[model samples]
Target: MSLEVEEARIVIRAGPRRIFGIPTYLNMLGSVKMAPARYLAGVARAEGRPLYAEDPRLRRALEAICSECAAAEAGEGRAVSRAEVVEAYYNALAPQLLSLAPSIDSIVVPCYTGALGEAVARRAEESAPGVALIAVKLGEGGCSWADAVYTAQAVDERLKSLNLGPASLAAISAALKAAEELNLYSTLVVLTDGR
Candidate 1:
């Protein structure tokens, strides 16, 4: 008998897994359960780096930015001030948020402060554009469910305007649905009456 060597090839096909009938990708960081601050701290610890919030230089810069935001809001009209604050705030936070990109799988604002929510979303976009950013609206104590729903809808609209792909949008929608089903507290309740 004669022995002959033949070339061989191996192929593997992989796709996102389905959860509750929805196809979702594997999130190394797991679900977006941690708050922004907690997530940042975790990332910093994992990387053996100090959180940006702990850096004196960044802290001072953030303070200056906050001051500037307050001045702009006070000097300008509400609408104009909002834009300025959002831009300034987002710009100030982008660096810190970006630093956590390696460890963070997603950013969830939880619909707390309207401006802050927008700023956080913008920061996430600037920091890790590919990462998921979800703004959730849940019922808050003393706040009507309708108000929360409205805020959620507004956030959804804003996120849509960001031009995120279908997957991102779907993720956000699914999160909102989960919140609604669980009757979570509304993070935007405080701002419902125009803050």
Candidate 2:
């Protein structure tokens, strides 16, 4: 499958001024479980490329698939440890995020894994310096890299209001709420998932 990341529209809300939405989840191949990062890692493993997953759940899933793929290939290749797959996924994301930086004051990211937020922040420092980084934690940890961090639960009610009821994905709602809180004329909110 093609590894090229796709772009989502910049959603501008009437009252929120420059709050734009970059829905990263649009790039997801199929189900929510098949997150872009997970898909990238899976493809890498299946192709006998070096990859690693730090999250226990993701690691377990990768291990199961990787073992099967390895056997299919008669164990010809080695799987490298370390977050290579995730890092590459984030690296693929940098260009898109950077493209939005010039037009916005800050970027709000939803952190499912802290690495996700950190990787974006690290990339911003180099290519989009001065643009603020705000992170909303959907899972746990992985938010220290952000200029500020808020928990998913803390923003749930506000998210509901913004989403016009119950929000299906915590990441998208949290991102919108966090951006609204910033009170900026323009903020780029990265919606990490759709479902």
Candidate 3:
């Protein structure tokens, strides 16, 4: 028996707000100093760089920050306002997103039902047309390793079947981070080579 393998290039895009329905805080944060310029520059520098998703130190720090934010937002019985939650999420992700943008072709978020998804989709279309913005359905309950494995497998199958190229896998690692963070149901995202 003989088997043939084909090769093509493709990119995977994913992240908070962009991929996980995390309530975008970038707009809210607004034009602060050289944020746009700085972030753009950062993205350029990161082009073709590897995703930071598997970094133990970064993951721990992100988790710790998210936990702290959740606690703060919880605020005993008061429960901070929705705006506060949005702000907290934004604060936590801005730096990373800006730094990773260049290497990321798109962000795939899981938003079963909410205006957040629509809003993000629109913004991505207008602000960064080159970058793809995808939304998908999320499973009930919490995220788990099983879900991640499933997502990875599905992606691998699609890539292999389509014979996509390395570019397709470019942002896969980063996208996985969003999947793990949001506990996505079915992973889905459309990405272009910025051509």
Computed on alpha carbons, the lDDT of every model, listed in order, comes to: 0.35, 0.55, 0.33
Pairs that clash in candidate 2 = 114-142
After superposing candidate 2, which stretches have Cα over 4 Å from the reference?
1-7, 10-16, 31-82, 153-169, 175-177
lDDT of 2 by residue, 1-195 (tens): 011122544454536455666565453242222343455555675675644444444445444545442222323435433355446446667566777787887877766666656777878888888888887766655677888776654433333333221123344455556666766566777665442
Best-to-worst lDDT order: 2, 1, 3
The sequence of per-residue lDDT tens digits that candidate 3 reaches over residues 124-186 is 444545554443334342222112212222344444444332323333433555456655432
Which model scores highest in lDDT? 2
Query: CA shift at 3, candidate 3, in angstroms?
Result: 19
For every candidate, C-alpha RMSD to the true structure in Å:
17.8, 7.4, 15.0
Alpha-carbon deviation at 94 in model 3, angstroms: 3.6
For candidate 2, report its TM-score: 0.63
* Cα RMSD, model 1: 17.8
Q: Which model, 1 or 3, shows the larger TM-score? A: 1
